[model samples]
Target: MAPARPVVPADLLAAVLRRDAAGPLVTHYDDRTGERVELSAATLANWVAKTANLLQDEFDVGPGSRVAVALPVHWQTAAVLLGVWSCGAAVVDTPAEDDGGLDDVDVVLAEQDRVAAVEELGVEELLGLSLHPLGAGMTGYAGAARDFALEVRVHGDHFVPYGPVDPAGPGLLLAGLELSLGGLVDVAGELADRLGVRAGDRVLVDARAAEEAGPVAWLLAPLAAGASLVVCRHPASDQLKRRAEAEGVTATLGLGLDGIRELGRPAPS
Candidate 1:
């Protein structure tokens, strides 16, 4: 058999955005904040563009740069990762903790709640996100850190990278995981079918668990399969079944559903 061509994260993202620009690509619900937000492929790309522009124009971050992401499992986190990759930059995702080291990163993107801690790290450039459903600025929030919500919007919605992304370049660096730009996409493509995330399917995911699996389960996997996602954070055990039905979920990642295919599980022979 001929070897299959390698998949690239940027290529997959562009393809999906072109194929389903108007369709909803991500639907997110955060139980803790009682927030629900949805983004079409075009909308998500817009956010990615603005973020990338911010990184490039203001921070001079681009290909080969490493940005530490200190945020939780949130929709905005998705945009941040994609934006960095769009600029050919690698993501260093570490939980926002007081002791987390960001000495190696060119910039740091942190959550509002964790801003105080990272602020003391003396990182060169830091952006604090509120994770607001509307992408609003952090309320009554003030600090030396730049406000991502307020600044990102001022950037252009359409992005033009300084140069093409290098598919073989480093893309991500987690504690126990590492992948090149193409390697990340390769894993996503390989897992797409196995995860039961097929085209036209709406895959419901347990945000908490999916986060543990990294961007593969939460972002690239669905796009690699030509599928969309509904990420439920802090999902209510009682409302899962009803929500699945309401969302027309065809597959699930982590969460078990009676008829829905469960991802990361083998299918019946």
Candidate 2:
């Protein structure tokens, strides 16, 4: 059978699940914390499901809802974005409650360290992420904010959207960018081609550039192209080549790996 067409964010993730459930999807390295984590497609899907269920059952998040993601580039952030998108909700890339970008958002997902900033948003719902590599709940929060990892565990393993999602509806909302679900898919496809992303490619990327490149490039662009990521939040300059070789990276985003393909720059013109 020919491949099914992708229309929404869920479709893109479903494609990865069907193609490589057990294969590594995201390999995260945090230099600041000396932590590393590798998550497979299936594992990520499960996390997404749990998060979606939490959003649905707890916050009543569904289609047409808006969520402001105030976390940095991390594996948990990846899951959070995918979870929100799976529910057919738009992710508003806002830093604070009074950022003036989004008129009204249903919820705000912020890192524990950044909770104070979003707390002022006055949104009815707020979920705090620990940015933990093992998906652990935040510590010392008490009753300040909803602990994402703690509450998400109570949700079922699978997610079922309350209603059907319209693929042509608005999805991502970022500064200078607004795209429907269909448009997001199209953008991912175009990005994959431009960045030389393809199936079976193990890509090493710098987290800073990934964030600047936006989610379509940092997260879903890889899924959209059947690629896996080795994201380095901060890399020691001397270990770049060694790390790439050790990780079997086929391409790189920012840090130069000898003879490896770099995104956005043509080679041997």
The CA lDDT of each predicted structure is 0.85, 0.84
Give the per-residue Cα lDDT of candidate 1 at 165: 84
Q: Give candidate 2 misplaced runs (Cα > 4 Å).
A: 95-103
Tens-place lDDT per residue, model 1, 138-177, is 8777788999999999999899889888888889988857
Error of 2 at 245 (Å): 0.8
Best by lDDT: 1
Instruction: Give residue 269's lDDT in candidate 2 (0 to 100).
Output: 61
Query: Following a full C-alpha superposition, what root-mean-square deviation does model 2 have from the true structure?
Result: 1.8
Model 2, 99: alpha-carbon shift in Å? 5.5
Residue 168, model 1, lDDT: 86
> Residue by residue across 1-269, what tens digits does model 2's lDDT show?
96798888888889998888998899999887889899998988999999999998888888888888887788888889889988888898864333454338888888888776667656558888888888898987865688998898888888889999888777899886789888889899899998888788999989888777788887877888889999998777677788889989999886666699887788856
